[model samples]
Target: MAAIAALSQNERTLRYVIDLPISSTEYNIWKPLFKLFLSVKDDESTICGRILQSLTRRESDNSQISSYWSSMLENGLLSTLIQIFSLSKNDDALTSAFLIFLNLLNEVPQIKNDLDTIKNCFSSMLKHTRSTNNQILTLLGRVLSCLSTDKLLIDSMVEQGLIETLMILIDKQRSSQIIYPYFDCLANVIGKSYEYQRKFIYSKNFLLLIVRSYLQDYDLNLSLSVIRFIRQLVKNNEELQNILAHYGVCEHLLGALSASSKELQQVSIEAIQALSHKNQKVQQILLREHALEQLLNLLERTNMSTLQVAIVCTLWTLCENNPLQKRDVATKIGVRKLISFYTIKSDEHLLVVTDAINELAKCAASINMNIQEEINHAQGIPYLIRLLKSDNEMLVLSVLKNLQLITCAPGFIANRKNQEIIVKNDGIKLLVALMMHAKCDIIQVESAQSLACIALSNNQCSTLIESTLDFSYSHLVDLMHSNDVNVQLKASNALATFVYNNSRVQLFLKNHYQFSFDYFQKFLQNNNESIRCITAFQVVVFCGLINEQKQSVNTAVGCGILMDILRTSQIDDAKSAAAECVARLAHMKSGVPQAIIAVNVIDYLCNLFSSSNDTTIGNASVALGFLSHIPEGRRKLLNRSQTSSIRYFKVLSNNIERSRAAPLSDYEKEQSSTNIMNFYLPNIRQKV
Candidate 1:
C-alpha cells in the first residue's frame, strides 16, 4: 500500500512541467528546474504556469510541500520567477507570476516570517497591474487584495496606482472571469482592516460594480461572490445600507432568493437581513418587491436550520408594521410548520429556532394572534412542556425562555391565549415540578418565573391555579438555601405568591416555619451580597404576608440574624428588609419584642435612627416604637446613656428599675408604632 501511494504521488509530480525546488538559498533542488527555465524561453509561460499550479495543489493538501515552496521562493528563485514572468509576452507568464504572488503572499511570509519580501513582491505586482494586459490585471487584482491586510503593503499599493488601475478595470473590463475576481478582490481588501474599509466605503465606482454586474450573470459562483462582496461593504457600516438601497443592490439581494444553490440562498438572505436592520424604509421597499413571498417559498423547500434562520431573520425586518407580510406568513408559511421543527434538538438549533419563533411571535402578536395557538396547533406546547422535564439543562432553559416570552408578553388577549395553552397542556404543573430541579439553577429560576407569570395574571387564572394543584412548599422552603442566588430569589418570589393569603398556603407555612426560617438565618449570614439581598426579600415576604408564620414560635436566632444583617449590610435593601421583619414581628403579641430587646436589637434600631438613608431610619423608628409598647422594651426605647445614646438601649432589659418605671400601654404602643410605620412604609417601598 505504501509503494502504491508513492507511485500515485510520483505520477502526480511527473505531470509538472518543471521540477519542484527543495531549498531556499542553496541550488540543490534548483538545477533541473533552472535548466528547464533556461531551455524553454518560448514556452516559459507554460512551464511557469504548471509550476504555479503544482505549488497551489500541494499547498491545498496542507502537506510539507508549501514549506518546500516557501523555502524555494524566499531565496534567489523569486527573482528567477520574476525574470521568466517579464520575458513572456502573451500575458501568460504575468498570470502565472500573479498567481504565485497571490498564494505565496499569504503563505510564504507566514512561513519565512519575512515582511520585506512581501513588501517588495507587492510593489512589483502593483506596478504590473497598470498594464493594459487584462489577464495580468485580473491576477494582480487578487494579489493586491490578498496583500492588503499588511498596512505597509497597502500603503505601497496605494502609492503605486493600485486603486486607479482597479477603477479602470471595473469601468472597462466586461468578462466575469475577470470581473468576478476583481469583485472578490474588493471584498478581500475591504475586509482586511478598518483603514482599507474606510478608504473603500466611499468609492462609488467599486460599490456600483459590486451591485451591478453579477446580477445579470448566468454563473452561480460569480453571482454568489458578488453578494458576499457587497456583504463585506455593508456589514457594520451603518451608513452604507442606504448606499446599497440607493443603487438597487438590496433589490438584487432579494433576487437571490430564487437561487438554486442553498449556500447562495442562505448568504444572500443573511446579507439582506444585515443591511435592512435599522433601515425601516428599506424594509418597506423589500416588502413592495414581494420579498416576503419569496422567503415563504424558500422556507418550505429547506430543512437547513441556517437557511431557515436567515429567511425568518429577513422576514422579521419586513414584518414589523407590515401587516400584509404577517398575514401572508400566517396563511402561507404556516407558523405550525415552524413550531413543529422544535424536537428538543441540539442547543445551537434550539437557539436558532427559538430566536426565529420569538421574532415571529413579536410580529404576529401585533396584528393577528398570540403564538400559543400556532404552538397548540402543532402540539409544540406538549413537547415544550415535556422538554421542561428533560435532564438536559440547555433544553430546559430553551423551553423556559420560549414559555416566558409567550406567557409574559404584553396584551390581554395574547396573555390569555398563552396562559390557557400552558394550563391545557399541564405545563404549569411541569414547571412547578421543575422548581425542585437541583442540578440546573437556571431551570429552577425560570420555572419559578413561568409559574409567576401564570399565577400573577389578573384574570381568573389565579383562581384556576389556586384550586388545581398540590405544591411542594417544602421544596421551595429547602431551595431557599440552594447555593444559587437567582434560584433563591425566584423561589422566594414564587412562594410569596403561592402563600398570598390563601388558608391552605398559611397551613403549609405554619407546618414548615422552622425549616423555612433556618434558610433565612443562614441566608442573612451568607457572605454573598446577592444572597444577602435574597435573604432580605425572604424575611420581608415571610414576615409581612403570613400572619400565622409571623406569630413567632422562636424569635431569638431570627432576631440575632435580623439585627446582624441590619448592622452589617451596607445596602439599604438588606437593612430595610431586616427592620421591616422586626417591625412586623413586634406588631404581633408574640414574645418577639422581649426577645429582640434581650439581644440588643434596640441598639441596632437606634443606630439606624441616625442613618443617612431615610428608609432605614424610618423602618428602625417603626420597629422601636413597636418595641416601646412592652414594659421592658419601653425602657430600652426611651433610655439614652451618657456615653453613647445606643449604649443604654443595648442592655435596657437588664435594668429592673427602669423597666418597672416605664409600665407600657397598648394605646401608646398602637398609636406610636402606627404613626412611625405609616410614615416609613411608603419611603421603604420606593427604596426596595
Candidate 2:
C-alpha cells in the first residue's frame, strides 16, 4: 500500500500501475491507491485521469469491481469524484470521471442508496450535456442514462430540468455520438416514470418533435435510438399510440421496413408492433398503408431469422380479427413464409415463430379461410408436430394450439385432412405425452383441448385417441380431478366430446368408471361462470350420447340444478347451455320430463321464448318441444293461459320453414320441417 502511494507521485510510472494485470487476490491494492489519488485535490490532476482509467480496466469482473467500489465509497470517493466532476473543465478529466461513475452505477446497484450525492451532481451533469465536446457530452449522457435507473434519482433529475436539457440536445444535435446517448437517456428516464412521460409528452409538444426527428433522420444510430425511444414510450400506453398514429407514425415505420439495414428494419418492425398491439385503429392504419405487402416482401427477401420473426409477428398483429388482412396475407404467401421459419434450429427463434403461426392459424380458422390447406400444402404440419417435442413448454403449447385450430376448421374436408395428417405424423402420441406428463397446467389444458378438437365430429380420430395408451376414459377422469379449474374444465369438455355420438366410448366409460354424481353437482355449482357453463354442456353431451346413462344422470343431477342455472346464471351462454341440458333430459324415456315439469320449468320455458338471445330462445323452444312429447306436457301446452307460448312456437316453426329457402337440400329441409312440426303440432288439433 505504501509503495502504491509512492508510485502515484510519478506520472511516468503511473501508466505501468494502470496497465498491471492485478489478480483477484491483489484487488485490495486498489482501495488505498484510490484514496491516495482522491487526496490530490487537484481537479485537473493527471493522477485522477490515471486512477479512473485503471478503475475502468478492472471493470471486467462485476463482483470484484462492485466490492472495490463499495470499499471506495466508504472512503469518501463519491464526494471527491462529484467535486472533481463539478470543478474540472479538463475534457479528459471529465470524461474519465463520467466513465468511472457510469461503470460504478451500472456494476453496483447499491450506489443508488446515495441519492442525495447524485441529486447534488445533476446540475453539473445537465450543464455538461450542453458541452460542444462530443466525448464529454456522450459520456455524460451515458452517466445520466445509468442514473435514470434509480427512481428517486430520476425524480431529482427531472426536478433539475433534465427533460428540458435532453430535449434541447436532441432537437439540435446531429452527431450520432451525441444524439444516441441523449435519446437513450430520455428513453430510460421518462420511459420509467409515468409522470415524467406525461410532462415530456404534454409540456411543449415534445412528442411531436421526437416523432418528426424520427421521421426526418436517416442516420443509422440516431434512427435506431429514436425508434427504441418510441418503442419504450408507447409500450403499453394505447392513448399515446393513438396520438402517434394521428401524426402518421405508422406510415413512417412502414417505410422503414424497406430500409437496407436489417437492424433498422428490425427495430422499426418492433416499434410498429408496440404501436399496433391490440389497437384496432392503429392496425387499420397500418393495413391501409399496405404494411402487409411490404412486410411480406421483406420477409421473402430477408435471410436473417430474427428479422423474419419480427415480420411474422407484426403481420399477425395486423391480421388479427381483421379477416380481409388475413385473407390478404394468405394470398401473399405469408403462410408459407411463416411455416418456413420452423427450419431454424434456435429455440428463441422457434418459440416466437411458432407463436405467430399459431395466431395466424387461429384467425384463419375463424374466417374459414383455406389457411389449413395452405399450411398442409406448404408441408407445415410436420414442422409443427416436430416442435411438439421441444423442451420449451410455451413452444409445445403453441404447436398444440396450431394443431387444434387446424383440426377444428369449419369445413369438414379440411378438418378431416388436417386430422389425418396429424394422426399420420404421430402427433397424437406427442400430444398424449404432453397431456399426461407436462408440468404446466396450461400446457396440459391446451393438449387436452387439441385432442378434443381432433376427436370432434370425427370417428377415426376419436377411436385413435381412445386407443392411445394411458389416454383413455380413465385418464380423462383422472384429469378431471386436478385442482386447476381450467384443467378440470378442459378435461371434462374433452371427455364429453370424446363420447359425443361415439356410443362405443360411452359404453366403455359407463362400464369402466363410476360416474360421480357428486362431482358433476360440484362442477355445476362452481362459482366460476365458465366452469358451471361447461359442466352443463358436458351433461348435455353425456345424456344426449348414451340412452342408458340418461336415467342415472337425471336422477342424480335432477332437473332442479338445471332450473337454478337457467334462473340465476348471468351469462346468456350459460343460460342457453343449461336450457339445452334441460331439453336433453326431457328427451329421456324415464320420468325426467315429469320431474322437469314438477320444478315449474314450464313458465320459465314460456318466458324464455321472448328472450333477446337467439340461442336461449332456440334452446327454450326445443325444451318446450321435448316436454310436449308427454301427455301432461301436452295438457300444459293446451292450457288457456299458454296462448302466447303456443303462438311463439308457431312463429318459430314458420321461421324454420322460411329457412328452407336457404342453401339446404330438399331432404334436409323436409327432415327439419318434419321435426319442427312433430314438436309443435303433436296435439295441435286437440289444443285448438
Each model's TM-score, in the order given?
0.53, 0.62
Residue-wise lDDT of candidate 1 within 1-688, one digit each (tens)?
2122222434354433224443334434444444444344546445645554454555445565454464355445566655545444546556665676566766565633343454354445555655777777777666655565565555555655666666676777667766666666666666655566676656776667666765767687778777877777676666777777888987788877787888989879878876777677777778788888788888888888777767765776667564445545644655576666564344434543454555444321311244555665677666677667666677677678777656643211125566787888888667766765546766776776676566543335556654445545666666666777667766775675454333455566767575345556566666764455445544544564343354343334445567778778787656766765666456443344577688887777677655544345445555665566566666655453323544323322222222223323333344444433211112222243
| Residue range with the least summed lDDT across 10 consecutive positions in model 2 | 658-667
The candidate maximizing lDDT is: 2
Residue range 1-688, candidate 2, lDDT tens digits = 4335444555346446534677536654445555544454554255656655564456356436533455456656677678766776767667777777777777777877785655467877788866788888888877877777676777778888898888877777767766786777777876767776666556436678766755677888888888888888777778888898987788788888878888999999989988988899998888888888888888888899888778777787787775445645655656787678777655656765666565456431211245667789999999998888888877787788788768763211126778889999999998888887788877876888788878866777887886786775566778778887677777877777566545667777777665555566677777765466567656655664334465556454545566777777677666766666675556543356787787777777666666666446655655665566566675676562346646566644443232222233222244333443333443653376
**lDDT (C-alpha, whole model) for all candidates:** 0.59, 0.68
Model 2 stretches astray by more than 4 angstroms: 1-79, 89-96, 99-124, 130-135, 146-161, 171-176, 190-196, 345-379, 386-398, 405-426, 433-446, 452-469, 474-493, 510-688
Error of 1 at 603 (Å): 54
Give the poorly placed runs of model 1, Cα more than 4 Å off: 1-90, 99-117, 141-168, 192-195, 212-214, 259-263, 301-306, 320-332, 343-352, 355-399, 405-447, 451-688
Candidate 2: residue 96 lDDT (0-100): 71
Query: Who wins the TM-score comparison?
Result: 2
Candidate 1 to truth, TM:
0.53
- Number of backbone collisions per candidate, in order? 0, 0
